[model samples]
Structure formats: structure tokens, C-alpha cells
Target: MQTTQIAPSNLGVTHPLDMLTPQEISAARQLLVEAGLVGATTRFPRLLPVEPTRELLAGYVDGDDDYDRSVLVTLLDTATGEAAEAVVSVTRGEVADYRVLPNGEHPYGQPQYLFEEYERAQQIAKADPRWQAAMRRRGITDTTHTYLSPLAPGFFPYEGETGRRMIRSLTFHRNFEGDNAWAHPVEGLICHIDLTAGTVTRVEDDYAETEPVPVPLQTRHYTPEHVGPARTSLKPLEITQPEGPSFKVEGTHVEWENWKLRVGFNAQDGLVLNQVSFRDGDEDRLVLHRASVPEMVVPYGDISNTRFWISYFDAGEYLLGKNANSLKLGCDCLGVIKYFDAFVADDDGRPVKIPNAVCMHEEDYGILWKHTEFGEAPQVRRSRRLVLSYFATIGNYDYGFFWYFYLDGSIQMEAKATGIVYTGATFPGQPNRHAPEIAPGVIAPVHQHIFCARLDVAIDGDANSVQEQNVRGIPMGPDNPHGNAFTWNRTPLTRELEAVRDANPETGRSWFVINPNRKNYVGEPTGYQLIPMPGPRLMAQEGSSAWKRAQFATHHFWATRYDPAERFPAGDYPNQHAGGGIGEWVQANRSLENEDIVLWHSFGPTHIPRTEDWPVMPVDYSGFWFKPHGFLDENPAMDLPDWSSYQGVPGTDVDDAGCCRH
Candidate 1:
């Protein structure tokens, strides 16, 4: 196998790195069968927990370099005669003991169970006489393919959890001649499958249109025969290293420029950064205790049986670390990059290596500072950023998660969504309530991608305060006749409920996390500002199951006292989880003044598809940043030396190295 130059091993990325190892993945598979919960012809087993337990993981993070060797493996037991949800403890390469997560209910949205049921649904759909007749009418042969992608019914299966069930929405494509299968549609057919019975109970074959609406299958964008021309850049620039990469890594700890932190992969969350600190004056000071993506929800908005109740809590539903996408050098990342790897299960329960799952590098962001004083030499400094990113593909959508440290003492967290949209078929001019049509007989439904970032703010010390500073125009009745004056109301959010404030566009509200005891040169307390980026209001209405489960998405920002137990906003098991998470935890109404605090920021964007968004989507981005407000005396990047003698190529720069070539 080919390898990238600066792989994680070269960066000192090591074991006990938080990601589930190959040995642990194999151990988990073996432990499942050893516990007698493996799925058989009649019996069914759905993996529920296959990651480190929170109780044990916290100890490793808070304590010294030593690690606790234990893994938590949980699953659903749905045999033909019996049914229950089980949790098993695996420690030191052996099954220690077992317990149940909740009293009496089955967890939803385990991929293995859904995959098996979807395969079974295919056979049952073929047996139906109406289905056969439809196939004949459409001249559906081996060339016209029929397949199903498993969908969470988003609600309780029939008889209130008697057994686990799923909805398999069938997609028909024209595959006989070429690869433009997506251009064709097998309109409006779905199947409901019962996992325990191993049978398709109901076939929602709604013959909506008189004839099956078929879209063109020879679109050049998808057909293999008409591949697009290669987009080539004549001048290729490669990042080089004379000595080595500027960044230093000792195990999971990383150091570059003035930034230092620990990076690792989690079985559920793809990337986790801990104990983030930056150079203060003579020593490094803590900014955030821990930072990571806790949860992400993708909720589709076509609420019929086939599309309704369809929301995937991505990091939770599909373990991001398990499906980490490998890096491809010049494409996924550039510059002198460092890559990280993790382990996951293969088809036969054997462990396989998922290499280059993470990439780190440095690049020029923009201008750090610039100024001109009359006739004096113009002063300018170029900006550089230390970036760490990882990609994960859950189903058809791929997300790129990034953390950037700027020379000006600012930290930016960003998520980019890019991939093929989840879609269904429709008749001509069929009214779409929350979607748009891309091609004939096809509808790309409306959906939202909501992401939440958890940051444990530890400024100067553990004790910090959050103040909501709102800027608003003064009323005419006050001092001035004209309401031109603006006033900034600096209000301290003392309680958790008070901190659960909305992002007020009218007031331009932003929160400041300050360390009261730490004052800068002018005897003023230093702090960083939390600015919520602009985005859409969540489309999931009140009373909807998705909205109920994701109540934390209602507001833009939240502040609560640091508590390791309160990690995820949508709870650990969001797939049909009976509420109780950040929305409930906030009710404790704990104080947030001069105490150990954590900030929860939510960012979301609604996607109503357009024609241009076919085959694949352009990257849609959303982000928030922690900027040094009063924390820095001046631009910390002032230390960057001026490029006094740099000169650009004159005639050659306009074209290239062209005289000899010409």
C-alpha cells in the first residue's frame, strides 16, 4: 500500500490515542458472540455501544499520562422468542461482566440490523404481483436496477417495540447501459420490514401517476462514456521542508507557532482536541479545557411515511470515527501535512486500518496587518494558520471538520457539508412542500444540517465569567432628539437559563468569556469574544418529533457550569431517545459567574435543493470563532518580521515561465 510522506506515525501520533484500536475492534466483535447476542437466522443482534465508556474516559483526560484499558460494548437482543437491550463491559481484552442501559426498550438506528433488513426487503418486494407488473410495464430488466437504502422509520415500530422494524425506500435506476442510474427514477415505492420476522409486512406501492415517470438516463454528467476533461493547473506549487514540519508532536500533544494542544480520534466523534493553550506572555495560558463536535443532526423535511420522522444524529447514529475518510495528499489537504489513522471492523468482524483519517498543516489565511504612513515604507504582514481537520462520510453526505489557530490569537472552528443529496422521485409538476426538482421524476427534499460544538472555556484559570453585551440604538425620548446614539448594555448572565439567550440580530449581541482576576497592561480584565455566525432558523416546527428531540437547536448559544456528565446536547442515544439532555440539564439553573464554565454553540443551515446541486453539491459552510477581544494588548502577530525586499516577477508573473516554451 502507498503511503503519504508525513503520516501520523512520523508525527509521533501513538496508541492510547483515544480511538478504538484494531485489537479493541476485534475484541468487541468476539465479545458480542461470546456474550451470546450475535445475530442468527431467527435471532437478531444490533450493536448499540462500541466505544469507550464516559465514566472511564474522563479519568484518563483529567489525570496523568496513564490510560485505563476498558471498552463498553452494548447491543439489542431481538431473537425470535426473546427481546431486550443489553450492555456488556469489555476490559483488558476479556469480557468482564454486563448490565442493561435502560430498563425495557430497544435502541433505534443500528446500521447492521438495518442493512440485513434492507436486503430482506429487496426479496419481498420482488415477490409482489403488482411490483412484477410494474416492472414489466416499465420494461425493467437487469439493466433497470432496483435497490434500497435503509431508513430509520423515525417512530416506534408496530405494537410499541414488539420488535425492531425499518422502512426501506426503493430506488430504481437505469443501470443496463451505463452509470447514470441516478438520472432515472422508479417513482414512489417503499417497503416496511420487520427485523424479527425477517419479512416485509407492508408495501406502500402508491401508483401516483398514470405511467411511471422516467427521467433521461443518458445525461453526460453521469454517463461514463463522456467523462469530463481534466482541470489542470500549469504551475504546480508544492510545500517543501528542508529540515522537517514546523509542528512538533509528542504522542497526542501537538505544538506549532504559539499553539499547543492534544489531538485524538473518538469512536463516536471523529476529532477531539484537549487542553488548548496558547503562548500568553512568558508562559502558555489555557483557553479552552476541551473542544469537540458533540453531535450533528440532519433532518429531512418531507413528512410522509417514507420521508417523515427521518432525522439522523450523525456522530451518534453513524460513528464518525468508525467511517473516517482517508486523506489523498494534494486534494484533501495541502502544504507539509501530517496524517492520523484509526481502526474499524470489516465484513467478517476482523479489524481493518483506516489510515490518514486526520490531516494537519499550515497555510496563509490572509493579511495579519497592514498600514501606510504618508511617505514612510508601507508596513504589512502576511497571515498564517495552523489547521487540523478530518473528514467523515455518513451515508451519502460527507462533512469536513476543521480547527484553525491564527497568528492574531484567534481560534476558528468550521464545518463544510458537501456530497450527493438524499432524494426521492416525483410526478411532473407534483407540489413539493419542502423540496425542489432537479430532473424529471426526481425531487431533492428540504433538509437541515445542524452542528453543535462543545467548548469548555478555561481562561487564565478555571474561574471565568460570561457577559452578554448587547448593542442597541437609544430611544428619542432620552438625551438626544434623534435616536442616532447606540448604547451597549453589558449584562452578566448569572444563571444557566439566563445564558440560554437567542442570537439577537437587532441588538448585535455577543458573549465575552472573561477572567476577572487577570488584567492586561491597562488594568482591564482580558477576555475572548464568542460571536455566533449568521444562519437560518431551524425549519423543524414545534411538536415535531425531531424538534422535540433537538430542543437545544432552538437558541444559538448556551453557557453552563463545567460538568463532564453533561457532554452531548441531544443525549447519548438520540435515535428515539426519550428526551432529557442539555435542554433538561439547563433546568438545574446553575450559576455561571466566576466559575468553571462550558459554552455550547449551535450552527445550522437549511438546504432546499436546486438544479445546479445535482450529482454532487458545492460545499456549504458554517462556522464560529473565538477572537481575542481585550486578551491581547495589540496584534500579537506584530512580531512577524516585515518582508522588506520581496519582489514579484514582472513579465514572467503575468504569464508563466513562457519564453523557452513559446
Candidate 2:
């Protein structure tokens, strides 16, 4: 859904699930300021719409217009390194709740980095005498064009740095203006700066006495002008919908075919689908209450001092939606499109609108069903799907999240990973176990892009139960006469601990969220199966920092009783926290029987870079599928229009390639 569109108004919010508009953000900031909560150094690290309670939304109808709107703003006092969270009701023009964040005690963590901190960190690094001396040792004196990347420093028990607002920087030299900074890496020099104190706390130079590893100086340009001549062999392919699209949009509520959902965006989670329902016959059956990819961790595999503590929680630490890309037509998407504008808070707690932040459109998906009988005309139907997608850039990597709703009562979420791979400097043909040399003198460390998706299951209604299904081959006995028999077993995940399961590809494992109260035509519980594209879970050893902090990625699936406060997979703030989130929530071991349950499925690719992944890496895809199991009585797409009506021109000769030649 990547296309350009005019930014919408930020004044009218008719629904409780509507995203915070520019006016609402300003009002919330004003309320905080009036309450003496916002000081000169107070910055908005995060702001999101407080999700309305279900009871409040139960009676909601379109055009109700007078609903309550609230914003939850996370405030950080940069001068004192203090943090607090406040909830302000924009409708009532009052502060609802406020509490100081426990960010200075044990399991400490700082708020997300401000956009202005990037420039500040660069200046701090360039001005430091120690950093400048290290640069001089490498024969580089011009620091005007140098780029000091502000990176999240993973938690460590160091004396001066523990429980402090900090940012670690890596220098990248640019030859001149418009030059790609990633091409030249200043290896073996790391700068640690205390953001609150505005001073460099520590400087690590691996080459203070020894010879330094030469930086990768080759111009690894990816842009068109730098790459010289462009390829002209390909022809332009155009897609158009002359009569316009079939989907209808009113505010954020979208309706396409039988699908109905509200598009939601915020600072943390990029795209959230709320109240997803599918029309079955005359009833709009509830499929999911909400769904979103809330958090993901990129844990590098290298053990060098430069990158050993290098696990990054992109959503929690950097905020995916806040850094989302403004999509362009013909480049990011095609066909008839609709774009949704997103408004987020900046450093000063002001409204910042990201125009055309979300993309929505339809795609032609090959054949849905096809058959050619021996003595009958061929029957075929072309498949079409509605796509809602967005892209976000975090540091060097770019990620695209695409959600598809198909006509056959199926849903799919895919994450496309592409961009420049994070690199380090190494001699050509150097042997490195954890980091692979993708290009000459450039090493790309092995890493995993583990994404956790939260699916609030509502098969027929809210009272649903999750059951693990495994298909196993039966032994060659009375049950299996021919030794090729197989049987499947469904084990109810009765508790949170029981639901902490992993994928078993050998047994064809899957999980089903079933409504125990609703029975299908065959007397089976109406259910939707979660099919995982199983891959290796977290590769970090047990008890390691990465394993402890990102426990959500350790298991392929987890089901817990629905709780509004239990939103993020890795707790509220995972920037430098010790460990929380799912690992702590399941301590209660809540029951999962006939109750509203949310499914957390973690899956992604464990990347091992190769030569082909050099300057820019192609898209590496990973995701899961949700489809109707026994929820539908029959094939949902059986009534699809057949494509066998088209007849070839009379007396026309057709070639074997399905082309007509006269």
C-alpha cells in the first residue's frame, strides 16, 4: 500500500480506536505543561493513544462523534535523567493519570533517543580530544563530514555507565557532500557518551599502540548516479484500475470484500489492525480483536568488543512507526492506492505529521483455483487480495511489513528485510567465525531478525481456547495396516506455561484458536489455525544477555490470557532493561481455557551473509499464515466467478506459449 496522498486533517477523531491527531497531541502536551510536568528539559520519548476499554467500545457505532480520546505520553527529563508517564484525556481536557517511571533503580532503562540527539552525539564525538586524537592517528583530520552513528548501548554492569542515559557511537567518514557514510568505517574506535552529562565517558581504541585495521575505502554506491549506466533492457509494466478500487474507507475503518478492520498507528507499533471481522453469509464473524507486530530484536552473533553487546529492540528502543518512511507512488507501490497519514510527537512534544505513512491497495495473486477435466472445459479463477503495508528504516536496515486479506478467509503477514547490511572492516580472505566477509575488507556479522506478532484471537467471539495440533505418523500396527497411516492429535494448551511451545516441522505442527462455545456444521469447534514458517529460534546460549532480555524470541509461540496492559512482547521499555515481558507475565501461569487469549508467535530468518549480500542485501522474507480450519463449513471461495467464459478469436492459431500468431 505504498503510494503518495495528501495529508488528512488532524482535528476530527470520531472513533475511540482512531490514532492521535496533531491537535490531540498538542492538547496533551499542553495539559502536561499546565500541570507542571513539562519543564525546559522535558522531552517526549513516546506518545500513543490509550486503547479504549472493550466495554466502552461495545456500544460504539459509526458517526457517534462524541467519544473520549486520550493520549499516553512518556516524558523524559534530559537534565535530571528522570522519566514519567502521563495520560491526558483530550476530550475532557484534563490529566487522567500520572506516574514517575522506575527508570533509575535495578533493571534500569532510559527512554528512547530524541531525534536531535543524533546531531548532538555527532558533535560530542567530533569535539572530544580523545576521539579527535584517534582520528588523527588514522590520518583523518577533516571532521565536518564525519558521521557518528548514535546506537543503543546494550545493558552492562559497568560502574560509570550502569543506569545512565547513554549512547555509543561508531564513526563513518564521508569523502564529501552527498557521499554515503557507510562506505568508510573507522574500525577499532568506539565512543561512549553520557547523554545527560554531555560528556564522553569512555573511549575504546583497539589501535592505540597496535596498527589499526584499515577501513573499507571502496565506493560501494547503490544510488543510480553513482552506479553509472543503468540497465535499459527491461520494459515498463503498468497497472491501473480505471474504475477505481473496490475497497471503501471511512476514516480509518476499511472494508474490502468481506473483510472489515480499522487501521491503527502509533509511536511504538507501526500498523495495528483493530476489530478484524469477516463477513460470512449475513453475519460478520469476529476473527481477531487486534493484531500487530509490536516488537522485534536484531541480535548480532559476533563476540568482538565492538559488537558483542549488540542486540537492538527496534520498536521499543527506536520506535518503528516514528521512523517510518514516507512512501512514494510507482516506486514503493503501484495501482490504485490509499495512503494514511500518521502524526507522532517530536522531541519537544509537538505534533509531527508523516505524510503517506501507510499504503493500501489490491494485488493480482496468480490463480486461486484451476482445473482441466478430460472432457470438460477448464475452470479457473484469478485470485485477488487486499494489501495493507508500511515500511520503516532503522539505522542501516529497511523493513517492509505487508498484511494480506484473501477472499478464501485467510490472512497473511510478511516482513520484507532489505537495505545495507551493518558492516565491519576486515582484510580480504580473513577468516572470521561469527562475521562473514561479504565484500573485500567488509564483514557483515551474522544476525537474526526475530519479529514477534501479537494476534488477539477471536475465532467466533472472545471466549476462545488454543490447542496445539501435531500430525504424527502412526506405527505399523492394527491402527496402521499399510505402515503409511498418520494421525493428528490436538492438545489443549490449558495454561500459560503449557502454551509456551515451539514449532516442530517434522510433525507438521500448528496451533488453533478455537471457540469452545461455537460448533461448526460438523460439530467441531470453530477455529482458525496458525501455520508457522518454522525456523531456528534465538541462537544465543541460555542465560546469555540476549537470551534473557529477548525471551519472547526463544519460543516459536506463546498464548496468554488477554490483558490490556500486557501489550509489548519485551515489556514496556526494553532499551536497557535486565529482563521482563513474556518471561515475567507467565509467572502467574494464567488459565487459557474458554477465555480470551492472545497469541504471540515469533519467527524470522537467521541471517548468514554471503557474497551476494554485499553493498545492498535483497529482501529476505519471513512471516506466518492464519487460515480457517473448521471455522468455515465449506470452501469459502467456491462461489468465485469462473474464468472459462473467455473464448479465443475464431480461426486464430494459438502457439504453445499461449500466444496467438497469425
- Residue 423 of candidate 2: its Cα lDDT? 84
Query: How well is each residue in 1-662 modelled by candidate 2, as lDDT tens digits?
Result: 22212121235676778888888899889999999999989999999989998887888776665567788899999898899999988777778899998888889877887898888988888899999999888888887888888898888878898888889998888878777777788887899998889999999998999878887778788888878898999886666565568899998999999899999999899999999999989999999999999999999999888888889999999999999987743246666678888999999999999878888888889998888999998888888999999999999999999999999999999999999888888777889999988878888899999999999988988899989999999889899999998889999999999999999999999999999899999999999999999889999888998898899999999999999999999988888888789988998999999998999999999999998886788999999999999998887788887745755343432222222123
User: How well does candidate 2 match the true structure in TM-score terms?
Assistant: 0.95
Q: Write the per-residue lDDT of candidate 1 for residues 1-662, one digit (tens) a residue.
A: 22232232222224334455665555566766776656753222223224344344436543333333444444444344233343433343345555554423543333333234445666666666656665565666563355555655554446533334444545556565544445565655666656556566666655644665554454525333465665576665554343456689775688988888888676566788877888967889888877888788888888655577677777665566666787753257665667767655543444667777778878777778899999998889988898999888876688999999988889999999988787677766788787688766677889989898898888887789999988977778757578677778889999999999778778888899999989988887889899888576557887777777776776788899887667778776565454446888899999998999999988967888988878777898898888888887776787886756645332211101111111
Model 1 scores a C-alpha lDDT of: 0.67
The 10 consecutive residues of candidate 1 with the worst lDDT sum are: 653-662
Best candidate (score: TM-score): 2
Quote model 1's TM-score: 0.83
